[model samples]
Target: NSKINLAANELLFREGEAGQFAYLIERGRIAILRDSAGEYQLLSELGAGECLGEMALISHDPRMASAMALEDTTLTVITRDHLKERMARSDPLIRHLLQLTLKRYRQSLGQTFPDTSSTQDLDYLEDEQQAMQRMRTEHDLSHALDKQEFILHYQPIVRLADRITTGFEALLRWRRDDGQLVSPDLFIAVAEESQIIEKIGHWIIDEASQARTRLASAYNGKLSEDFYVSINLAARQFPDPELPGVVQEAIRRHGLLAQQLQMEVTESQILENREHAISVLHNLQSMGCRIALDDFGTGYSSLAYLNRLPVDALKIDKMFLDDMLSDQASRTIIAGMARLARDLQLSFIAEGAETEQQVEALSALGVEHVQGFFFGRPFALETKKEPA
Candidate 1:
């Protein structure tokens, strides 16, 4: 049985006081008050079914606001101890609701502006709000990221001249809790913004290397053991002083040869920090690891940096490969890039080659490697290899 009372006006808890009990309004109304300049200001109004003292109940901390009866209000009181005992045996749904309540409270505080402060306080509050939003995004992403939630999909790269499978790129896919497959573009940005890109990038390296090792083991008795796995590297992960050592450890753990794994770096990163990027590339190349400049022509002065960077390959951006037959400029660019790659003794890979015409154009351009939907969309690497 709960203690119920009908309280009148001036029946409120003092500011900075501790809360030992939570209250639920059963009748009339209640007002939540906060101290501003030594005066109480109404923060919110509560009616039937509305609960108060939640934060204090959860943290056992001092109450930041006071609850007072607006009129002759009937309230049911539940002691914090009782609430804790109930929470200890609460159902998952109830626990989730409490968590959501806490999240919403934090969000509200993040968005609220304090009126008693200067303009600087407003700017500070805005920054705090952004930080809080980022934290929430990270929390949600962390819940979504798990080994069981990730799946490896492979897309084949073909030799344009022979129209044969050269190798496959391991792509990450997530079949979300909602049973829908999430596109990389959707979650990749969130992961990057939350600083979780490093974890995801490392996971990709490990998964791709493991797949390559398994394939190698399977084809040990076969005539050809010439498949390669390319994994994209985030620019944020590059500056880590221990990155080279981490890559070496990953290779050893996965039983993969350093030459079999290619690290794909966006061309823009190379152009932005040429010196640092070159040093990193040199370190990787020293370890016998191959490096590919991804989205090659998309960057400014990309051709200029190509000579400076110790990259082994150039991945032609998909934008250039799209509508290759209809776009003569694109065809010319691809041809020039392919010729330059040949002259420089570098491998040229045309990405997103989706049509027969595109494949034919690339072959004619002497582009050796091509990857796109025309060859194969990304799929899980099962034990058996499907036809090229």
Candidate 2:
């Protein structure tokens, strides 16, 4: 369906026009023409399997040459979005090298075409040194998985009524070879953009599932009946139709009850691909796993969609707790969320309650559960006693 039919002698694109797509000749020939003064002259001819119009996509410039179908051509069109997405996922070293090559090509164009040098060229040259640093980081990330350098830290989610630890959210940390610990914020986006999140996400699910039993045992079986390990699902992983199967396998392999594994997702993640997201969530529910809406009230939190979702809990964002003491608006919003959660029969958890007073205020606002440093910070399983 992405294939297009072009008539013989058809102009695909003209020089001086913005390039929106690159085309692959699937079944015919294409002519590449360059304009000199006011007359267009043949520059090159391309046959089937050849690609054209891609330079502008990489260089962020107008088409340098025009393309026309030499015959009844069938071409596969690659959109700018597709190219840009792939470029974003490529290593910084490769991207920089590509830009450098393109820059030289542009410079050589001065003999025939107009000189196209600009500030963008200067910026690319300036960042040449930064490429090595970025390349090293990228190489480190590529090997981090094979080296088993990732670790999980659990933060207690405490029940307000009895002040007991009922569940813990599993947080990921990258431990570099040099003994440096990297936070998720530092490298998660990179992993997601590079498509490494899929592999890492599966590993997290497996680790958390295995940890659930050990955690309960560590607490001498005093952990509540609702004891669960909450694993944050990356947005990039949801599009995989096999995600539910992955979770099911994790729970089954670890001999865990599906309810003991909670999957946490943010609002924006759900909205980005609503149909697929809903399908994946429903499949998870069918396996008896629970779903929690994390970072609630921060993004795309629509009541209409919220009520329709197969969610079991609401985790209020930490920002609300940060401002709850000084801002009446924050408290009012927390109160409304608590009441909404209760009315909907969903569990309510307020995050980032650092002080007793904040916990008191959250408790007064009808929050049923809380998670923050006030109870216990995120502690590694190997370094610390089991979550209190």
Candidate 3:
């Protein structure tokens, strides 16, 4: 084995290079990349003790990817000639292991390739027909909304420093007729483009408020009266001048207090049309409701808008906190934001705190609240009492 050192950002291998050697990493990390339509796509990451270039060595073919060192790295290189020489002197079991590795590599390549052939062209036409049929299925989904195919789930946001459950965020999910659950990502965009977001947003407000009322009644003066429910507002629906009046009516119908409900708007939505969004936010706030800037620091002008808007809270974007343990810059930024929140008297929450390390870091940073899979996944409103 030959030892090689790579400097930070150095290219370890180029795509389509002849692979004569496989490598075992001894230090640092490498990112594997594939070229797609002339642009590089990050495929996977490899760290210490991980092997790379093995696919090419096993298949005796050109390298399928380009790899680059993320930091200074040390690697142990084993040439294909040496491996073949070892195989010649090894037992049948070693030869079988090498053959199995080649078979797996070919299987993986087959799974990654796109289907393109004369028969595949015909299959493509058939697939288009299937896609059109699926469009019809959307009509079923549209109709099912009236039948309650779409429902709201609540996930609690607890104050990490105090362990107090301050509020629940309402999340949407779809229960399809085939018993398959569809993610909101698949349908929410379609609904927004079709202008159905307004109806759905209103539905969420009514349902969540009613559920909050029921929970309060069940707890019967044992739980904090300030326990609130938060729902996301679609940007398109915000332009309606009647939104405050509509929400007020929903509050009256559910016998819920206005301050017990909050509205979360994404930073991108507010930054896109700051003047109009600020106006809408002010209107909502005037109606005795609280406003939160969701996914903060994720959009252009997010910090600028935060200073201008009358928002009560800032939910730090999850991506920033995800790498806090490994990235000093992320931790520094989050800690700085928490300090800014304290100075501004704005409540701060870190979303996507998935580990004990992340929780400890946020607590140390003085972030008031935390939410993520570490606490619990979103659950149906009736099931909220279950452990997080």
Candidate 4:
């Protein structure tokens, strides 16, 4: 009896998975699918005000088909406990019929009954389904990269001190032939797990370098004065000994100062293979490339030797700013990170800022670099430099 909001194309449940809950669509449409010859066959589409997976309420039967939101949808969720309680109070004949119906439905799907003494088996089934889906997505992403279906979108980063646009962060976007945009939230994690991140990381650097050259041309050779495009590197990529050389080559090929490009890695990524990461960062810095520790202050490692990490900047994670105005503790922590950055002589950037008040709060805390909606949304760019 609670509402859940789902983004477009979000999965609600899969075929053959135990139905732990059902939903009534309050808005948008849902696509029901099933496997047919190794591909998904859309069986039907449900629209607003329709109930889904209601049969599962009567018995502990598995789902018969997959359900996915066709658009942004809001659904009223009906928990299993409520359904079970209602069933218990029903007439004996009705309950018996429901059990028989569910048994036949499972047999129709060629499913075998499992020992259901606990819910562990059901949980495992759901997990396996999700894993399989991710595997398929990974395959698609590999092909996407080859076909050039992927592209980069740049979001502006500004300096609070001068209120000037310094540079942009090169973010990834996957646009399919159908003109639908696949969210990075869905694919980035899968790419990271499948070890395809290294190739993606390289492509991003190559693209960002080319873009920087263009951005500089737009500024009549002045973009490099203080402007720098930041590219994110996965922690897993650290183990690739060739990474340093690869980045240095990109900088050399563009004939741009390394300071015009920055590489950002999360705090946790820095610790994934600390020794290897340290070596790579040193090599990058030696080549004049600036290094930024992204999502700063979120890692579990102690900050005892932060100075030894070979980083030139720290990006205060957005989680700290979510409540900076209402929570004094959040503001204090942000101020401390700013002070620490100053003492270490490393630059600091505040991310996820969205308002003037938030900007003022960050300014008072000594954060001079900030990037967020407060600046502007990311806009698409041509690989070649455009007139600024």
| Best model number under lDDT | 2
> Candidate 4 residues 1-388, lDDT tens each?
7899999989999987987888999999999999776798999999998999987665565787899998999999988788656655654444554555666777787767673512633533444455567767878888887877778887778888878778788888888778788878878877887778888888888878877766655442113266888998887788876777778788888777888889998878878888878888898888888899998989887899797888999998778899999999999999999999999999889999999999999999889788898887666666443443
Candidate 2, superposed: residue stretches over 4 Å from native:
1-43, 46-98, 101-118, 121-135, 219-222, 383-388
* lDDT-better candidate, 3 vs 4: 4
In model 2, pairs of residues that clash are none
lDDT per residue as tens, model 3, 109-135: 653332222242253344445445545
Instruction: Report the C-alpha lDDT of model 1 over 99-150, residue by residue, as the tens digit.
Output: 4565467558653323222242253344445446656656666766563566
lDDT of each: 0.73, 0.85, 0.77, 0.80
Clashing residue pair totals per candidate (backbone < 3 A): 0, 0, 0, 0
TM-score of 2: 0.76
| Candidate 3 local distance difference test against the native | 0.77
Each candidate structure's TM-score, on Cα atoms with residue i matched to residue i, is 0.63, 0.76, 0.62, 0.66
Top-down lDDT ranking: 2, 4, 3, 1
Model 2, position 203, has a per-residue lDDT of: 85
Tens digits of lDDT, candidate 2, 52-99: 888766765778788988899999988867776776666666778887
* Candidates, ranked, TM-score: 2, 4, 1, 3
Give residue 349's error in model 3 in angstroms. 1.0
